[model samples]
Target: MLLELQQIIVHPGQQMLLKDISWQQLENILEEMGERRAARISYSNGWLEIMVPLAEHEKDKEIVGDLVKILLAILDVDFEPFGSTTLKNERMRQAVEPDTSFYIQNQGAVIGKNRIDLNIDPPPDLAIEIDITSRTRFDNYAILGIPELWRYQKQGLEIFLLQDGQYVKSPFSPNFPNIPIVELVNEYVPQCLTIGRSQAMRNFRSWMQENLQ
Candidate 1:
């Protein structure tokens, strides 16, 4: 959604400079909730957009793929790392695109393209956001019913676990507490800008081996 401010000039002798600001909010509401939905939101100065994946996004998809491949090589799991998508709120009439998202093995049940028709439902299990700007209000995760969220900002990582319909900072995760996400992110993210994907994967593998032992 885009919002704009307008200025109108009337006559020459009778000068009239009328200043008017206009804002628009766009919402995509569904009648029945589907597997997922992706949408964008606009704010003044900056916007908070989320792309709910019918499938994974580009770089994020690649990252999740690598992580899953590495994890499967080391651990015994029958699942694969699903892609990220966007989500929306019909009741509140808001939309946001999470930076990165995923559905763990067997979590999706079914998958399709086009768009996930979410009438009203809880969001994905994990939503990742790269915080380029400080949120004027608390992050919009809770409003969308996302169970857990990982936010990266200022070279620091914060994990928020949803409890009692609200988000609370917790080191313990009900879903993948044993995964040590913080350590993995800390080690891998820095290398993202400097190294190749293969090298990063090798380093992650090495780190996992040491940690597992």
Candidate 2:
């Protein structure tokens, strides 16, 4: 026989208070439980939300890393990868944690912790989101000042490139025109777990080496 679990209702802003409990109190509770992954926290307007990854959620991170590796090997661009860092707009008093982000070398840039101080500068060159569920707003990139944003869903990949301070649908990437978004998503993401990271990377390299003419 199957058993049903009860659901608990939580108010929108109450979750953040959990973090305020003493670290020692939390540690004691955690000691009796299985290992838990760290949570990524952010404040949306005035609501606090925390993102906790499942133990088996490594596939998304692996796929993103593989994409970065493939891009670096195929293109001669310089970039650095950051995962889930807090980006803030002080003027707007908003903070966001992008799933994956990158910075191009020699660009006017500033970095922050818990919140990035944008001052008057624009966002990063690229931001990637792996969407398991629908988001409340699709215009997060615009609000964050991101120039390029890619969202990967089970249906396919959506590419939004910012132009003239607005987002537009484009067939070619403004940052890397030669790399096709759809093809990459179709080819690499589905095969991430089956082939394993090293072998998958080797296969990707071989494919790119053959096609990058």
Clashes of each: 16, 0
Q: Kindly list the per-residue Cα lDDT of model 1 for residues 1-213, writing each as its tens digit.
A: 542212322221121211221222232212222334332232221233322222223354356446645765676544323344445555544445555554544344424433433454335566666553323123456666677777665465678887776788877545565887776776686675479677888888888888875
Candidate 1 stretches greater than 4 Å from native: 1-84, 120-122, 133-139, 209-213
For 25-139, candidate 2 gives per-residue lDDT tens digits of 3334333322332444444354445455443434575586567657765776666566655565645545556667777642435444223456655566777766653242345
Top candidate, metric TM-score = 2
| Regions of model 2 farther than 4 Å from truth | 1-37, 55-57, 105-115, 133-137, 163-166
TM-score of each: 0.61, 0.70
Q: Worst ten-residue run, lDDT, model 2?
A: 4-13
Residue 14 of model 1, lDDT score? 25
Q: Candidate 2's C-alpha lDDT?
A: 0.58
